[model samples]
Target: TNLLGNAIKFTDRGSVRILLHLEHGGGAPLYRIDVIDSGIGIAADKLGSIFEAFVQADTSVTRRFGGTGLGLSISRRFARALGGDIVVSSVPGQGSTFAIGVACGPLDGVAMLNPGQVLEAETARLAATEQAHWQFPAGQRVLVVDDGPENRELIRLVLEECGVAVDQAENGKVGMDMALAGDHGIVLMDMQMPVMDGYMATRLLRSQGYARPILALTAHAMKGFEQQVAEAGCSGYLTKPVDIDRLLAAVADALGGRLASNADRAAATPQAAPVAAPTPIPTPALALAPAPALVPAPGPAPHAALPPLVSRLANRPRLHSSIRKFTSRLASQLDAMDTAWQAGDLAELAALAHWLKGAAGTVGYDAFTEPSAELEEHIAEADSAAITASLQALRGLQARIVEPESPADQLNDIKAST
Candidate 1:
């Protein structure tokens, strides 16, 4: 499917075809699939390198056709793992065909459903799951504080589906005001925002004697952030693309109901200590090594590696939809950051980078975190040239944000490989 998708994406005005057949070789059966595309084909010299991770035919290809250059690498890995191999044939200007051959045992007693039937059944199952309603305590209000409009909406949609009432604030100041004005059962506070930040807001809330359970919502899942959240007097913490089940579990636990296990909750909660001057939370970008310079002539695009999305939420279509929406918004956010940089508004630029850093991890765009963090540092140093380079690198990273495949698709690929 990935190969076919890429084929179509690269093809300007040509048909793509898929052919599947069976063959007998050495007393065993083999399944052969061919994906043929009348698209911009690979150069003979670059053909072998294309299957390597981060290696595209050219840098221009990445700008023209967006991809992380990971699909073919992953596909090849899957093929090899399944006792098969993927071979490609291409012409510079004509087209390309990818042949995937996997070894299969004799099918004498096997029952096989048509691929279309299996796909339809799986789609139906997913649809049914999406339609199945979940129930939560009525009027159980939660406060969500984040600068991203799309993120706020995504969280609201997920929580509202579970029958929770949600109030949102665009920044820490508004969050602080709303928290004081309303009776929220719990507060989901983002660690980085303008006008104020989660750390300051949390400290103020604690100092002022408002004692509702506050869960730190952060983009940085690196070491020490949990400690930072704890030090700030938050009750708990959650990392982004917040999983639905985990979010509900956290909420329920915060509200003194145990819908989900509390094993991890202790880590999120503050460890009791005598009050002292707060330890400054280190910026997440500082944790990442600087990315290598972007080579205009691409062999492999500079790899900005990120951890995979949490598996529990990866299977859900709603999460995927949310991710797509978040990534779409990322482009505009980058643009805004550029504008802020051009205007010499370091505060605005820092705030945008901080928000972008936090939000990127939730949607499996961890690669963005480092560049964003670097942007923040550049703004702090008042280095205009560094800011320009970092912003440009961020735009490049944005193109490489790879969406993970569904679990079902993974299983199917595994089965095909074997």
Candidate 2:
């Protein structure tokens, strides 16, 4: 809060103390934090209007302590919004203490940490941030083997930013051949893919004396899965909802050369096409093109907002830009899924579901992944009734989303070329 900052600014020598107190009342617990400081104290008259907007102790104090006087006002508003208030006590020429009390609804299931632990956690986070800037080898190629076009595209777009060339394989069969033929630094192999999954491809490659690192990608994080990955001859494994930093870290671990912090791709070879910044398409809504069969809307409509699939990409701007393309592709996949369902092709249905399971989460349609995976499970079980039910459930999930009014716009032209 501003009180702490203000205290720090005014106090030149003595220590500033933050004392925390808690009380249990009729309702939720109330937390009161007192920021005490040994500094030039406020006059008794000024204490009355100190909480007022743009008002500080005095001109001399302002000359000594520089701040906009906005942080306190905003923080006061927030405190009141939570059914609390901030009060201050000071003696002229002595010191000042400001206390804020607020009701915290619940502490259930929260992991509490002390100041030392928090500082340690912050230190680790900074190290990860610096490591993210640590460069991979320039012009090093990484092979991405997966059936989902969107998944492959997501991996390619991220790696290319770090000066890596990416080659795609729709299935493990092709991945094996590419691994043998190309000079790739590492392989990111998706486990549940069509035409020879990652396990078989890795086994085949290792059998043929291909010594490069093969990292398995899977949605399954069940207990004891790492043993299976080791048995499959993978160097390690990564899970779904493809995280950008985790992907980079995995590649770093495999290559054993995480050096440098600032460098661009070598201009000698062009990187993969950069995804355009998200802009409105001509069509208002991006999903459910050639709309599939669906049941009635849900019991309650979801509030209009960015889906979790897309929202998580807010930090990775380049990768985030591909959202429009992912939604456009989603419509086509829905149509294909419907067609496959009409013909009762379980293998095709499961494959489409599997792809959707990975693709939906990658592009911010995370809620869609559950339904897609459910449909895939039913198909794998070879239960026609469950498959039909699960298919309807998937269709219903798209139907429930409330549309945002003209969310993207005039930027459509910028989006189209990509």
Candidate 3:
């Protein structure tokens, strides 16, 4: 269901066809279902591994598909639990075929259909229902593990506001301690952290049989992480700047309880909490994050050799605001274009290119978006350089935006260097 759903999502002009080949024998019929799509294809070596659960061919696919990777793994488990299995094959430039084989038999007779399992499945179903009167109960707890203060605070703010009580740990060690000590409904785990990252923490949790949901929260919302996260025993995955709606939906689905998606975990009206004085800083004409340590560029270049200069300047408040606005807007724009490219929407591709050109240039990314603008002007000409260069710039920008420190800290770095 998850793979098919994503196939439909990412395939616009192409056809998605499901072929069922059924055969009768061995006192039971064999039902073979093949979901074939001319969408983004998986690489040859990865074809064998994707069914291993949470495995995707590429990171770009995960951002486009927006899934936890549990869907296919769970689906496969369901198939196997019924004495059936799933097989898959694909060619990177071609397409993919997911073949699910099932034995025809009375489900009640299946040993996996016990009453407890039945009840748990039904609870999950009810929890997934979109009914308004169905309240899943408040004070339900979740353990959030992240090394970054901003990320933890953002998640804490979002979840606590939803009436779901929240607990937090900055590193894996603390997270494991709290997780093992308490009976929480779920764990929102960050994959990378200090002392003990989420991957190790989850491994430890699972080894101890902590059955509640454990979801991976990371900026690397790529395909492979899903399977990797699952190996760590996490139930699902959530990308950064966590989408409130998707997060709640996944949590509700995983925890067997319903929660309001509108309930922002981070929302809170300040009461007695003291407000700190705001510091002022200069906003370059274009605000950029400190570049990443390793960029996705095609070739090798000293990461620090990249240019670090101001495009324009703003007041202190504007500088802070501009940085946030700058980083977020570009990330969102690039992400959208990637989605559009996958869907093969030329119009959207053109529009995104145009928008990026305008926004990047406005914020001093002319060095980046300018090439893309020229490409947009002659998309029919197939300007690969423009496209490749633009992508490289975006990659470079991601590094800059997510420096070892905050944009605020980086600004100070710039001042000190100056």
**All candidates' lDDT scores?**
0.72, 0.70, 0.60
Model 2 steric clash pairs: 309-364, 309-365, 310-364
How many collisions per candidate? 4, 3, 16
Query: TM-score of model 3 relative to the true fold?
Result: 0.35
- The digit string of per-residue lDDT tens for model 1 on 286-342 reads 011222222233344224322233423455566676676776687888999889887
Candidate ranking under TM-score, highest first, comes to: 2, 1, 3
Candidate that would win on lDDT: 1
How many residue pairs in model 2 have overlapping backbones? 3
Q: Candidate 2 residues 1-418, lDDT tens each? A: 5688677555544557897756455555667777877667778888778777878778665433334455678888988899777877776545677878788666664444456766766665555555446467666889999888778998898888777789999999999999999999999999987789999999999999999999998877668889988998999888887876789888877666475532332222222332333221132111111212223334443322213233456445576556656666766788888899889887887778888888777766676765576576566767666666666656655654422213354367558766
**Per-residue error (Å), model 3, residue 255:** 3.8
Candidate with best TM-score: 2
TM-score of 2: 0.55
Q: TM-scores, in order shown?
A: 0.49, 0.55, 0.35
Mark the 10 consecutive residues where model 3 has the least summed lDDT: 284-293
Superposed Cα deviation of residue 393, candidate 1 (Å):
15
- Which of the two candidates, 2 or 3, achieves a greater TM-score against the reference? 2
Residue 169 alpha-carbon offset, candidate 3, angstroms: 0.8
